[model samples]
Target: MESLHRDDEKRTLRRFLRRQRQALSEHEQRLAAQRLCHQLKALPEIRRAKRISLYLPVNGEIDPTPLIEWLRKRRVEVYLPVLRPFSANVLWFVAYQRDTPMVRNRFNIWEPDMRFSAQRQNRLPAWALDTLIVPLVGYDANANRMGMGGGFYDRSLAFMHRPGPSPNLIGVAHACQQVASLPVEPWDVPLTAVVSDQGYVRRTR
Candidate 1:
């Protein structure tokens, strides 16, 4: 079927790009992360944001911790995505602070501990944030993103499809992850902009 073919194509591209980024040496990865932090911090949207959500890098994903720290110093509230309990393909953004306890989620990624009842008080809805820095396996100049195929972000950000205000969705990735184009799906949420080690790619469309 046509659907099956598109799925296969996406799988192939994801495998290739994941391998490409993972192949980078430690030094290369570190340098790329530093440059990415520099570029991201310079973005006017980022500097103006009072609240933001950022992810901890894993599996060769560009590190955003440096930027997170910078934001914290500026008194900007930083949040991390927590897998919503009992919710299918959805996430809750929980405030991340120095004292916030962390636990590894099902994917083995560290996230703010949601088990503590107090943590719930700090949680914010996805659309409530001013900006969200998302990790991507691959992206294109058009601001289309290729995620890890979990659909978590797509589902949580589905509100963007409706109307009204939406947080600025920014995709972060290594320069090597840039593809000529991506086969975008109807369910996939497009990004407002993408920041890579090379520079920022603002979506004209």
Candidate 2:
């Protein structure tokens, strides 16, 4: 059943993402992103965090540009994840600024400098973060997440939550991406909350 669920979830995600990508009539994609941004602008979490880590947005990905701008204006320390280069499966978080230069990765998504990316960026203790905003292919109101089959975020968050000093794990997604329920593996890590154009789902229920 787990394997079947995963397959179904992947197929659904692929179809939804592709349709979302296609629905954009050039300017529509930009507008959709902007709408998503506008909705998140009023979230208490986005308004409160001092130290935050976020995955850089990619194609048809919910744009974090507005949040990033807000963070910069408020003098919050913002970080971005970078998949390591040269045979490392770990992720690293690097300090991001408006001026931080970005180059495309092998997958064609824009990423921060590999030299300062998440895994290679720093060795700071995990408990130092106040909040983390994760991206997911699909998620539910119950905080269950279905990622792109990589457990980097799961392993990292699980490790960070072991003792004291763990940050809140927030997820950002489009309302369309929300599922009613999802398959959970032993390694899956639940999020604290989720924000979408539909507003926030606190996930405490």
Candidate 3:
């Protein structure tokens, strides 16, 4: 079996996903996104978490912007990840209320104001985050995730695997991002669950 890190496999998948991302008409993409939103709304895991961390979309990844908006309205304290300039580590934080201002950063990703974070940040040990909604290129029911090779999330999860304080780690992918299986490394963090437009699947291995 080809491993995910295999240069050929990653290249092949990169091209495939790029084409797939471009082929979707905006309407089709948004509808697919809406379906995913609906499916997620019905998940007990989401409902159970009071504090959550999510990412701003890049490429055509399922936009969690809508979910973030709704979460705040429901009084759910939500956090967004801020990747430090030139650093892989992120400052996961809250303060993205509907009224929060966003500015285009050098990375071209829009970010919320720093004022949203506390003057004295909680900076939970990675594992202590109640729920981490991770982004993925491909995932399978086995809880494996294929990322862009940045190793940010992987390292963060590794930090969580310490003696105590690891929270539920879930991968959020588009229905199209699912694959037959994915290759994982010893240091790779297995996801607790994966959710797509189709539904949620827990990896039991």
Candidate 4:
């Protein structure tokens, strides 16, 4: 079937792009992170944001932590995505501070400890963020995104499908991850833009 073939193509593309980023040297990773921050800070969405959500980097995902200090200095509230307990591949945005307790989730990715995230005061819904620095396995010039195939973000931001306020979702990845084109799925959430160490691609469609 056509659907089966698209799924296979997506899997192949994901594997290839993942390897491309993971193959970067430590030096290259650091440089890319720095450049990524520079591009982010210059964006008006980032500068004017009072509350934002970002994820910790893993598997060579472009690092957005460097912007934390700058955001903090301006009294901006920074949040990190915590895998929601007992939820179906969904995320909860939890406050990330110098003292926020951290623990590895089932995926071996670090997130705010449940003890801290349990308190409603320490977290916010995805829709409440001013902007979100999202991670992706791949993207295209049109700003279409290919995530880890988990559909976590797509499900979380499904509220956007309706007419109402929604956070600005900004996908970030290594420049090498860009492909000529990508198959957009019905469940896929459109991003405001995709930024990389090299530059950025904003969605016009």
Candidate 5:
């Protein structure tokens, strides 16, 4: 069926892009991260944000953690994506502070401990944040993104589909991850832009 072919194509592309980013040397990764943060600080979305969510990098994903100190200095509330307990492929943004407890999730990605995340006063839904720095496996010039295939982000950001308060989604990746084109899916929640070490690709459509 046509759906099967598209899925196959997406799998192949994801693997290739993942490998490409993982191959970057530590030196390259550090430089890329610095350049990325520099560019992000200039964006009006980031500058005006009162609360923002960011992810910790793994497997060569561009590091957005560098911006935490900068954001904190400005008194902007910073949050990290916590895998919601008992919910499949769902994420809840929990406050990340100097004392926030940390633990590794099943995927080996670090997140705030469940005890802290369970406290309703400490977290916010995706729509409530002013901006979010998302991770990506691959992207196109139009800012179309291919995630790690888990659909966690796509599902968490599904609220964007309706006419309501939609947070600014900024997909972050190394410049090498940009591809010529990508197959967009119905469940795909488009990003406001994709920023890399080189520059940014804003979604024109």
Candidate 6:
């Protein structure tokens, strides 16, 4: 069936891209992270954002931590996504700071400890963020993002499909992750922009 084929294609692409990024040496990854921060800081959306959401890198995902100090200096509140309890594929943004308690989630990723009273108070809805930097398995010139296929982000950001203010979704990855094109699914949310180590791609519909 057509649906099965699409799934197979996505799986293939995801494996290839993940391997590509993982193949980068430590030095290459560090350099890429630095360049990525520079490109992101230059974005008008980032400059104007008071609250932003970012992720910790895993599985060769581009590291965005280099931008944290810069954002902190600018007094921008930084948040990390915490999986919503008992919710199917939903995430809640929790404030992250140097001293914030962290715990390994089911995915074994470190996240703000929501059990802490202070951390709980820092939670915000996704739409409330001005900008969100997401990790990408692969992206194209058209800003179509191929996520890890968990559908967590797509489902969490489904509100974008409705008529309402939505956060500026930006995908970040290594330049090598760029593909000529990617299949877009109905449930997939298009990125506002895609930034790579090289620079920002000129998004075309």
Estimate, for each residue in 1-205, the C-alpha lDDT of model 1 and write its tens digit.
Answer: 9999998999999999999999999999999999999999899889999999999988999888888778988999999999999999799999998899999999999999988987899999899999999999999989889999999999999999988999999999999999999987888887989999989898887
Which regions of candidate 1 are displaced past 4 Å? Answer: none
lDDT of 3 by residue, 27-55 (tens): 86687678777776777777777778787
Model 6 ranges off by over 4 Å: none
Higher-lDDT candidate among 2 and 6?
6
Candidate 2 backbone collisions, by pair: 92-118, 92-119, 93-118
lDDT score, candidate 2, position 200: 63
Pairs in steric clash, model 4 = none
Off by over 4 Å in 4: 117-119
For all candidates in order, the CA lDDT equals: 0.92, 0.69, 0.70, 0.92, 0.92, 0.93
How close to the true structure is residue 125 of candidate 2, measured as C-alpha lDDT?
Answer: 35
Q: Write the per-residue lDDT of candidate 4 for residues 45-152, one digit (tens) a residue.
A: 899899999999999999999989999999999999988888899988988889888899899999888775254478888999999999999999999999999999
lDDT of 2 by residue, 1-205 (tens): 9789877867787577546644556475566567766766676766788888877666566666666776778988888776655534456566776677777777676767666444355433335777788887777778777776667687666675456556778777777778777676777776788777566677664
Instruction: Please list all clashing residue pairs in model 1, or write none if there are none.
Output: none
lDDT of 6 at 36: 95
RMSD, every candidate, angstroms: 0.8, 3.2, 3.0, 1.0, 1.2, 0.9
Q: In model 6, what is the error at residue 66, expressed in angstroms?
A: 0.5
TM-score of structure candidate 5:
0.97
Query: In candidate 2, what residue range of length 10 has the lowest lDDT sum?
Result: 117-126
lDDT of 5: 0.92
Query: After TM-score superposition, what is the CA distance of residue 24 in candidate 5 from its true location, in Å?
Result: 0.4
As for lDDT, the candidate ahead, 1 or 2, is: 1
